[model samples]
Target: MHSEEDAASACAHATALIAAGRLAEAREVAETALETDGPEPTLLLVVARAHMAEDEDDHDDDAERVFRRALDLFPDHVDLLAGYAELCLRSDALDRPGRHARGPVLLERLRELAPDSPQLLRATASTSVLATAVAKGPSAALVQSLDLLQALTTAASPEAAEKDARRRAALAPYDRRLAVLDATLTALARPGRAPLRLLVRRRPEYLFLAQLTVAVLLLARHVLGPFPLWVTCAVVVLLQLPLLALRLLLRGARARGGARASGASAAGPAPAEPPLPAVRPYTRRQLVLIGAGAALAFSAFVTTTVLTHLEDIAYPRYEAAAPYTFRGMTRTDTGDELDTTAASDPSGRVAAAFTYFYTGGSGDGSELAVTASTGDFHDATAAMVYESDTLLSSTPGVGSLDDSWRADAGAYGGWMQCSRYVEYITGEHKAICFWADKGSMGSVSFKASDMSHADVEGLARTTRQTVLLPASSDS
Candidate 1:
């Protein structure tokens, strides 16, 4: 049986062997120690490392299991926790969706044990950056990443710090994380960078403040008249100054608390004293509520603005001076005009009234109908066509003689038909065409009993070109 000293030495030797890339020898030494001592922490760590070194698919799982067993024996052992946390980091175990997984639990415990430990800081920072990128956005992730890198550099030894710098520089061109790190380092190297770095590191909540400020500014712009660039810049500065002062006050309080704790610890425990009242600057729940409220308000304001703009586009006022004439229809008729602007409709529907009509000598006619308010004629024309289809479906005497087809009409396009019959008005079958151009909706219905489908389509196309195209060109 091996002595305690022999087992300790064996564990050290096995660790050295594993570090030297001697996996087989490390495994043998670790297995022999485990058989003799029945699973000490150091021996288990060595065995876990040996398992991790093996070139196999399940090596990570095997090493994690071994580390877990060691952790059960020595829960507070920093080295075992560190090793397990590192394994978790490599495996992305914290990113998995679940409640308090082994990886996150161990990392939190390690943070409590050694808050200023560089390795732990680095792991937490990396994981936080990744998590923030997924949850928030790229800008937030970049800010958090820079903060962590700063913390890492402050906590790490000179050699390790230099190594990290070099590694980041090497990876900057290929990886976005390293690129952000490099940019932040460059910014820090310049004059007057300390204050900026301090703000980023201590006041990450400023990112949310900035977003809210922008949202408010957009809401203002929509409500009031447009402001100049310099005015907007001044507004942002004015808004942020108060928040900056508050952050500074919180930071000062934290510093003073740390100093008091250090002094109390140095003087040893005092006699039983009264507990101090809790003073929290901000809680996680409060921040979440604030963010959610701000986001919802911003979304509502933006959506309302967009819908208002679309409504204005969909129901624009009709312009009377605009030309609404077409070929094979020359005689202007004004008797059938219907104006309903004076009458109130309870349904609140905007009334469409026939504005003008042109009749041909051969009993062919085209009519121009327009709503009282001007709107996007594209949508107005589409709505009118849809209404016509509904009428055809619901009206007993109205029926289509052939399938409708699309035809290009000047700068825009519309639908045309060879034959559409109204049995109640039965004298001659007619072709029906509807088109939108130059911000106006119009329709042409002509005797089509002797007209071919191609002839109907051609007539509709030519009418749109002659009437609407010339109006748009003149405008």
Candidate 2:
């Protein structure tokens, strides 16, 4: 029953507000039109436009907020649906948390409402895997995304009733984009093409550093005592290794290819005379194999370094060393060595201790684990204890280790529990020992302060000896 004039006026005002960077105002106007006229697709479309405008103006949160609101208002609307899908895609690209929070459900809704929209189908193929991963697991997400993409590729094919030329033109761009993506991937897969340029230049240095650092981290996390310095150093080094390896592999392959090609051409038939010796050009297969083997070796080295350190990453003890004294299961606030056997004589150096304990479910009914912080990492002193569980999951716990806790005196950062572990050999225990002293130069003035990894590790070793180790053990 809505007239053209009413719809036009509402849409015009909405568009003008959007143009003037008044997204919130535009949304209000569009909503007013919907209230007055009842379910006008164009008005809903205008509202989505306003959301997009808001997103462009650095108000992505507001944009998504408004998009969701408008979708709620017009659930069966396709244009609005497409707008939502595009917003989800953009959100994922921007790494905005919870962008795909509602993607799978919304995608399912779209399938039921507008099953024929190619863009929706394409998004399902591309975005669903990640969406599902965020909402579920990686394996499930990947499988779903692939299925959607396959379905989309099939659905968008030329229908039998269409004119060949028109259909080809209509489908040509989509085909070309897919082809370009495949070609780019193909080029990347040709031996040494994995964006490893940085790694290539410093391959030898990186591999050596990676191996040494990994060993140091293992020693600290498992054998010495968990020191933040060791864990942080290991992470930065690990990230750089792959980049360096890719670079080295690419460079080495190029150098070998150039040498082989030059050697072959030089020894081949000259302009006037055939060569007395038959020179052979190396097969592409051989070059590929060599490049692959080199890449594999580099990968193996990095993987070995990563895995070896992971088993015992939690070096949780970091208090001044104390004398060993066992007194019938006495527990200290700071982890002290359990030498409760007798009143042991004090030694010259303090003892360091690293302990790992898991507690959950009533003594044993059905079995459930409720992980809790051991307070070792929460110590407000200068001693920082770095801890990680079996999986190396890196779950953001009750604290910030993301280089944001460098400031605020008298407050130490808390530990994060990571469930995502790799190659965990159950029942195998690991610990590291180290200590550190907070120097004036080590003090931080802000959240983004850069502390010396080496100094921290050294201090950690010292601290471990003072606190976790028993002074009388050596005696």
Candidate 3:
């Protein structure tokens, strides 16, 4: 004989207990409410939440069972669907192949119940972004997420929008997801007349367009020999400037027309004037169509490029020459020949060598190897060389000719010199030099029983100037 107020009070008490971290107490209260007043949606939610609050391995399983039973009783409840969807999203069930995750299903149901609701739209959009990420990739998910956020911000109440902005701002510094969201929001909120405002607002479309343009530029470069990346980028920006200006002009015209219409309506209409000739200017739909066409063209160009240059792109050509002389040692054709390997992909090229050797005056053998790669490898090579040098310096009984002797290979070069003379570990004395220019790197190891530290240094310099320079220049 419990009243409705008693049921409400019991549900509230259970919610408070769960929030206070008293899962057992919350479960007890919810169970008591269910027994007293039958299975109500609120009581069921409380019971489900209480089970979820437990930190056991099987807590999610128990929570799912409870939620399923509650949903059976109250199928279309927003609170129940939101809770279930949230649970599914947080669980690994979504990652299972060939299985439909409950999160999307529940979110879709919630969307049906409240299509225009800000909270429902946000949840649905977020879930869609996650689902898209799993199925497609981050880029596709990013585009969808940006569109959803733009719509959500435009439709939400001021308070809700402010809260969204605050949440994004707080997470932007630490989380990439929120950082992207913050950037999109910032672009959307830009002043109407600001430079690139129109382009930024339609970022996803423009980004796609930019991608297509870059792909075409890459294809053109491949066919026309070579072009600088900065030059290509500049051309793309210049091409888009006219379109941006047109959009700005259209926006201004629309604003002015609206103002004139307001003034005319306020003053009352006099006589109808003859209509001007119909002029169909470029619309947003038209612009989108143009972008789609460009994307399709880019796809064809990329496919052609891949098919035509498959061998050259997949397996780049690598060339290296053995040093003629090193530290008064003449060329020995009997020694190790240059063993070269080259690899390439859409990113860039990498060339490696292993068996390039030299013989000193005393018949002592030495080896020189080089690895050259395209793109930014400066910092990585520097850090790796520094670490190796530190370890070599710390090794006992290892001495160097001049600790201050640094190789100058130009602006984009990193060099390290170490001695191979070990008093305690094998009496074999040698000199090791590692140098990098831009993305190209080389290592020279000199082993000669009578070779002085100065002689090794001279050999290292000669190796850099002759053997490694050619490979680095091509990089």
What overall lDDT goes with each candidate model?
0.53, 0.41, 0.55
Provide the TM-score for each candidate, comma-separated: 0.40, 0.24, 0.33
Candidate 1 lDDT over 1-475, as tens digits, reads 6788988888777765554344666778788878987867888888876876663438767888888789889988877887777566545445433312556887889989987887576556535646534422334243434434454447454345435654643532222233334334443445654555555444535556665666666566556755654665687687677566544543443344323332221121121221211112334764675676578557856864785576445532343342444554453656545435323444433333344445544643343222222224434444555445753465444454455665455445433332356445665566666655325455555566666667776766655444333224333
lDDT of 2 by residue, 10-82 (tens): 8876765554334566688889988888877677777766766543535556566656676777777776776
Compared with the true structure, the alpha-carbon lDDT of candidate 2 equals 0.41
Worst 10 residues of 1 by lDDT: 270-279
Residue 467's lDDT within candidate 3 is: 53
lDDT of 2 at 92: 56
Which regions of candidate 2 deviate over 4 angstroms? 1-5, 12-28, 38-41, 56-58, 93-95, 118-475
Better of 2 and 3 by lDDT: 3
lDDT of 1: 0.53
Question: What is the Cα-based lDDT of residue 431 in candidate 1?
Answer: 68
lDDT of 1 at 124: 69
